[model samples]
Target: MEAAWVNILMLILILALIWVWKKFNSLWLTPKRLEKILREQGLRGSPYRFKVGDTKETLKMQMQAMSKPMNLFSNDIGPRVSPYDHYIVNKHGKNSFIWNGQKPRVTLTDPELIKDVFNKIYDFGKPNMGPNIRSLIPGLAMHEGEKWSMHRKIINPAFNLEK
Candidate 1:
């Protein structure tokens, strides 16, 4: 009986250590490693801030921008709608990146580069969004491979020039 209890405790301790390591790796180590890789590749942006990243700063900027009324004569709504993005673009140039929580979002200003990414669908994969956000906005954009093709086929007719 004593030996059995000791074995069970040892198993629990091992499991607990594994869980802790996984949490630490996912929450801190992975993000830091990704940040380092991006920085080394000549991309510039705000440093990763634990789990929250730049979400707090983004929300604050958005709220402040939206508080003011829009200019009737001005067509520049980018600043008002996406204040954080606007600030980032202005501060860090066109090829900069921003942290959306643990994910790093690289902003590409060149039309050709954007086209190339869209063309090579299999080469790049979409980032994993939380369940809450997924539930709120479920659509073709979230899908991949066969599902994406099916969804695109259904929606393509709506975007036809002849229509």
Candidate 2:
């Protein structure tokens, strides 16, 4: 009976250790490995920091850009609207990456790549948005996969020239 209890406790400890190892690998090791892979592929960008990543820097850039007033007639709003994106592209080539939290978002400025991405929508799915944000603005923008396709199909006819 005592031996059986000891065996059960040992099994539980082993399982706990395995769970912790997986958690660590997913949270830290995977991101570091991915960062190395991305760099090796000639993709340049900010180094990944634990947890928040480049979100702080992105927010700071946005705040600075917003504080500065641009010419009202200027058509170039890309710099103002996406200050971090503009900075990253200028600082680290157009094929650079940016982190929205833990996720790395590759900036594809080339028209060909942009078109390809649009054509192959499923290959690059939408980011996982939290329930609160999804609820705030519920529509086609918040949906994914077949639901998004269905919504687009339903809405496309509304904008057609014949209509």
Candidate 3:
């Protein structure tokens, strides 16, 4: 009986891991089919990075840019030393791909998803942050159930920039 129970537990754990990995892969892993999608539509950009993504490089560049004086940036970094902002400068041409980790995201220069977002913003849903990502945030954002709602309410005023 004990051996059977252990075996069952191990199987369940393995299955759960497989599920999470598959989910992460489907959303965040890839040689990114989006690349082809963009290419077929006629676009250009940088090659995608595998796994750890561009997050690390972006962060590094951003931090490096920030370390210098704001006024010194345009001169030092050649107009774009910051990470996110450099995304525009980083694009050697009109179209490009920026890796969000292993995932390749299509950068559409002419795309108006931005306007569409603000136009019918109410209809759109919150961006998916992947499973339990907030939990890793190391703050009240990790709370769930009623606790999360309460946390949000309590911290709302604190986060208000105007306040």
Candidate 4:
């Protein structure tokens, strides 16, 4: 009975250790590594925080920006909807990035880079959405790899001027 209890405790301890390690990597180490990679690539923005990320700051800035009424003639709604993005662009230039939870969202404002990213679709994958959201709109947006290619090929003609 004593040996069985000891074995169970040992197994639990090992599992707990593994879980902690994974959490540490995901919450801290991975974000830092990604930040380093982006910085090296000449992208600049917010530093990687432990857990909360820029969510609070983003919300605050957005609220402050949105409170002000925009000119009716102005077509740019980017400032109202996403003030953090606008601020980052102004502060860090076009090729800046920002933290979206654990993920580092790099802003690609340059036309060349935007075109390149679009052209190489496989290289830039879509972000994972929640199951409820995914179910609500599960069309081509959720697809990847060959499925996305097939979907795009079929859907492209629907919007083409020549069609």
Candidate 5:
């Protein structure tokens, strides 16, 4: 009986390890695969740096430029979007690809493609916000469904009109 449980546990662990390996290795952190995709698309930028990629470089650059944030931009209106835009712009020359650690983003310079893509954006489905882990909050909400809704509604007033 004890040996049976041990065999089951070992099988579960093996399956879990395989799942994790496939998830992270094949899906997101494939340097060679991404390189091939970019090369095929004729995308120009720095080569990917394994898992860390551009995240380290971007963060380091962000800290260095944080002191003199004013000097990070070229045009007057460009800096208004976000602080990271300045970091991106400083590197990409207005139209270039940026590696955001996990993925490479290409800023399109061609006006025609931009307008066309914006017009025909319906093909893409809404993004998955991923998984929802159960919380330790003790209430009707902890139970399920309509109970959760009622609890959420009751809690909403407490948060909104707090004195």
Candidate 6:
């Protein structure tokens, strides 16, 4: 009876340790490693802030931008619609990065770079947003591989100049 009790306790302790290690790796180690890689690649942006990342700053900027009224005649809506992005681009140049929670999003302002990325779609993977955001923005933009290619084929006709 004493030996059985000891074995059960040992198993439970091992399981608990495994769980804790997984949480630590997911929440801290992974993000820190990604951040270092991005910085080494010459990308600059806000440092990762635990699990929240840049959510607080992004929300504040968006709220502040939306609070002000826009000029009806002005064609510049980028600042109003995406204040956080505008602020980041201005502060960090054309090719910079921003943290979307644990994920680092790289901003490509150069037309050629954007074209190259789009051309080699399989080389890059899409960022994983929260469930709420995913629900709001679904379809071709979120798809990958065959699904993306199929969606693009189905929608390509609408953009043709001769159509």
What's the CA RMSD for each of the models?
A: 5.1, 5.2, 10.3, 4.7, 12.9, 4.5
Local error of candidate 3 at 39, Å? 2.7
Query: CA lDDT of 131 in candidate 2?
Result: 90
**lDDT by residue for model 3 (1-163), tens:** 9999999999999999999999766755445676667667666655555566677777887777667667643455544445663564466454556667656654544435543433343474444566677556644434445665566567656444467
Give stretches of model 4 more than 4 Å off.
73-76, 130-163
Q: Comparing 4 and 6 by lDDT, which wins? A: 4
lDDT of each: 0.85, 0.83, 0.60, 0.86, 0.60, 0.85
How close to the true structure is residue 83 of candidate 4, measured as C-alpha lDDT? 90
Candidate with the greatest TM-score versus the true structure: 6
The residue ranges of model 6 lying beyond 4 angstroms of the native Cα positions read 127-163
In terms of lDDT, model 3 sits at: 0.60
Which segments of candidate 1 are over 4 A away from where they belong?
127-163
- Per-residue lDDT, model 1, residue 19, is 100
- Comparing 3 and 4 on lDDT, the stronger one: 4
Clashing pairs in 2: none
Model 6 residue 9 lDDT score: 100
Model 4 agreement with the true structure over 68-151: per-residue lDDT tens digits:
989899899888888989999999999999998998888987766865665577778886789889778877768777887788
- Span of 10 residues, lowest total lDDT, candidate 3: 113-122
Clashing residue pairs in candidate 3 (N, C-alpha, C atoms within 3 angstroms):
44-95, 45-96, 53-101
Q: After superposition, how far is residue 79 of candidate 6 from its true place, in Å?
A: 1.6
Looking at model 6, how many pairs of residues clash? 0
In model 1, the worst 10-residue window by lDDT is: 110-119
Q: Kindly indicate the candidate among 1 and 5 with the higher lDDT.
A: 1
lDDT per residue, candidate 5, 39-153, as tens digits?
A: 6776566667766667777666566555554744466644444445565657655555666665666666565555444334345222333235234345542344566456655
Tens digit of lDDT per residue, candidate 6, span 18-131?
Answer: 999999898889999999998898888888889888889899999999899999999999999999989989998888888888877889877657656765777876767888
**What's each prediction's TM-score?**
0.77, 0.70, 0.45, 0.77, 0.52, 0.77
For candidate 1, lDDT tens digit of each residue in 1-163? Answer: 9999999999999999999999999889999999999889887899999999899999999999989999999999999989999999999888789998888899988665665565567887866789888778878757778887787678766544477
